[model samples]
Target: MTSSDLWDAETAERYDESSAFMFAPDVLDPAVDFLADLAGDGAALELAIGTGRVAIPLAARGVAVIGIELSQPMADQLRRKRSDIPVVVGDMASTAVPGTFSLVYLVWNGLGNLRTQSEQVACFRNAARHLAPGGRFVIELWVPGIRRFPPGQEAVPFHVGAHHVGFDTYDMTTQQGTSHHYRRHPDGSVTYGASNFRYVWPAECDLMAQLAGLELERRVADWTGEPFTTDSESHVSVWRRPEPPSRPLEAPAGA
Candidate 1:
């Protein structure tokens, strides 16, 4: 069984509509630009690529892009948009795909979906396994929001909107959390949904990269390359595989 929560047909179908704001040019262009620059004529693999939000635009920019998604329904949704982009339905932590990539990325806090430290570490290893020498693995993840909790508090409200209300409840000991959402329909009926995740610290991610034989290259607060500070709520981190050393030239015969 997959460790991650599966997005069923209903979720997949409504995903684009529910997440419309994320598709705005202002919010999306910077991410595409950041990733495209890193891809730089090389292919990229997106872990948990959902509905081609970033992948579609990134591919339109001439970057060869493929995806690994845990949810077949989500993959089907993506296929409806672009048949040319291939997607494999499997667990991102251990799924294997053909060909090495110059860039492998997991965005939108996808790493947290693993829900276990071991799985998350294996995910790093899997990314490293798919990366060519000097290739980079990038992840956009939220820093744990425990700081927002007051003493004895376990829940934090992340969004309080007219049509949608969302909050997260945390278990400090396990570093696990669940984001709960309530969406009101036009008819005034409400729907509820929740997803579980294991929150990870940036330092823990650094160690995971190290264990995967990748070196930390950069860490920014966002796709725009802002400085990462303790107060930052999220981070976009990049780790690179080391390039092979150049061979020394041999001396001329009888030099």
Candidate 2:
């Protein structure tokens, strides 16, 4: 894999600053509050918990949070911020973090990092493995913006700013995409970075959750419980592992 394929140390160092939009309280609080309410008195496990962005604050709200992160550098940033949250260094796709949790969440399109359907399905199974009965697995994902694509065009610009340019190039046949970003510096130099993802639709995600023995409980357009619709650009979906069936009480013989 190329250095860019992995979120290595250098990339981790700038993840927070580069993705500041994700850290804004307006954007973050609703997500945290939604997960916190679901967690209740039970613990929550976060997959690909980069820099403890959500986990740290959720912990501050008294929800026990554990994280599994593949990038040590990203986890280190989390540590530098706060040491209270337990973080395990491993791939979120299959890493076995000890103890079952009431909630397992992967936010901000982190599942896209898997880059393949099987890996993403495994991630769902892994989330199921770590969940207590009736517990939830939540994911925040963007709906693929196909309408923006022109005929015969495979690329679409998503962000254009005074100092940065961002776009996505897609391969429709394979459902793969590469999101590219270029940051212009004061010295007139440019830095380019790209991230790979395999976009999965909401229906496809429900099938993956079914394969993991979980069921889609609810899917909203956003964190505030808005109804999902065709016009929605993103969604926050919740899947639940069904609680075990209760055994029927037997009456006394010949009662």
Best by TM-score: 1
lDDT of each: 0.95, 0.91
> Predicted candidate 2: what Cα RMSD to the true structure?
1.9
lDDT of 2 by residue, 1-255 (tens): 211146889889988888888899999999999999999999999998999889988999999999998888999999999988889988877789789999999998888888878888899999999999999999999998878887888688888998889998888888888999999878999999888989889999999999999999999999999999999988999999999999999999999
Q: Please give the lDDT score at residue 140 for candidate 1.
A: 97
Cα lDDT tens digits, model 1, 66-181, are 99999999999999999999999999999999999999999999999999999999999999999999999999999988888888886888889888998999888998899999
* Candidate 2, superposed: residue stretches over 4 Å from native: 1-4, 186-188
Report clash pairs, candidate 2. Answer: none
Q: Estimate each model's TM-score.
A: 0.97, 0.95
